[model samples]
Target: MEFFKGDKIYNFMGKRLPFLGFSTILVVTSIVLLLTKGVNFGIDFAGGTLVQVKYEKAAPIDKIRDILNKTKEYKNSSITKFGSDDEIIIRVTTSTNSVSSDLSDEIRNVLKGTGNFEIRRVDIVGPKVGGELREKGLMAFVLSLIVIMIYVSFRFEWRFALASILALVHDVTIALGAVSLFGIEVNLDILAAVLTLLGYSLNDTIIVFDRIREGVQTSKESDLSKVVNESVSRTLSRTTLTSLTTFFVVATLYFFGGEIINGFAFTLLVGIIVGTYSSIFIAASFLVQLKFSIEDFRTKEVEKIKKQKEKEKMRAMFEQGTV
Candidate 1:
């Protein structure tokens, strides 16, 4: 089924500049926010204790914070409501000598008289381990990009590879920026989400690229712009259907997945939207700017013909000289 009807053509390439500008603004804003405000790194990467507590009744976050602050040891603690008002998550940096069990007990004791609560879970990460996790997370992201570039280069061409990589970067940057902007906690799970997004965006981009490749080989259109535009139009339905279904699922998870997986789902939600936009506008439009044409794909055949003609000319020259 087609999302767009009739034989009408949409000029997706024509408006690439504006779309690129918009993306540039988003990426820059994200970078600036990342530098200034920074990501709210969770216990997984920030070396801390995370305590999840569920109260019998809804509790005021400010009161909980006030109660924790009364104890000098817990004065610097950060308290936030988790999935619901009745659930609270408390985070505190781990002391050099404190054990995870001790930290949980201390937190429980501090808030004991304030409300009837149960400790659902406690997680601890030491400074050394958190540092390692942070470094590994960054490495994972970089390696994924390198692998994706290599795959795209082999599957298509260098220009397509570069375009796809740039588009992926754009999608990732925008997603991270959204995370930073909204003060979402960045953790291992969120990193996994970003990687998942990388794959999703790549899949969408490859579909468009594959269609464009086919159009170049089979379509009568000579203009690269026309070919790209037609290819995108033809694949519009598939792209829309895939993105919509994925978006719906991620949105559902975001709203109801609880605090544990909220970051993961949120990343996917942003990435899917940005990824779809980049595949349709940024990736294919970049090919037109690079002067990509059918000739580029037929370079080997053209070179062979040139060599054959040169050989014939040399043979003719030798025969004439001998005559």
Candidate 2:
């Protein structure tokens, strides 16, 4: 399980330029793809009606799809088995911004002869609501990014924070690009996945940054590049272990979790790979470019000294019974 040795000093920073070049091309291509072909929006962001049906017996999925396709009114309808073999959920895109109250009844009527089925429930979303949800999702993303930047800025130097934020942006942009490129249906669940990705990527970057900061402070080496390489090498095993563990779980969900969660699983799968990559290559590379100064370490030392002085002062006051 140990992918790297404890004392190994990997030269991860040695070929950082080529990795940076590759990342730049990838980020640019992803941006282009996103612009030219936007992600496919689902009912969570696009108005539609969901009809849940339960058949008396096992449902014929393909036959039901064919039946829906042949009907001009429900030609664009999509269906998937949700619960048991006898139950299924059907999503019908509304031709207009409004949804018909009798959509479920109409679906039942259309499939009357196919099987003895009961309409379990129906959920309708309006275009206005969907639009609002879409706006909110985007707002959440932007606000989270801003908050993380502010946090990192306070946690470390401005340059380190800037680098961390850029790496986050890089991870998100490419993940969105992959969703767009594959024409994945972007829904509320998928939005959740994207947000999850931001947290995951940020955690990885923070781990590496903390190590680098520690290495810079404690090591005698004045060369920032050497410090970065050693820091990354030290933390490589932890990062890889975490990434692989999460990837395997998400991969299982993508493969066996069924169609209901396909998009969500796929989003996480891509996010795991891209997030892990950007954390090491993109975030760490940005750190190398920023050039860590010993002065940064001095700031921490000053704070520690102040804290120690405060502790000593409190001890004296307590000993004299004047605390």
User: Candidate 1: where are CA atoms >4 Å away?
Assistant: 301-323
TM-score of each: 0.89, 0.83
Compare the candidates by TM-score and give the number of the best one.
1
- Which stretches in model 2 have alpha-carbon errors above 4 Å? 52-91, 95-99, 113-121, 295-323
- The residue pairs that clash in candidate 2, if any, are none
What is the RMSD of candidate 1?
5.5
Local distance difference test scores for all models? 0.87, 0.87
Residue 278, model 1, lDDT: 88
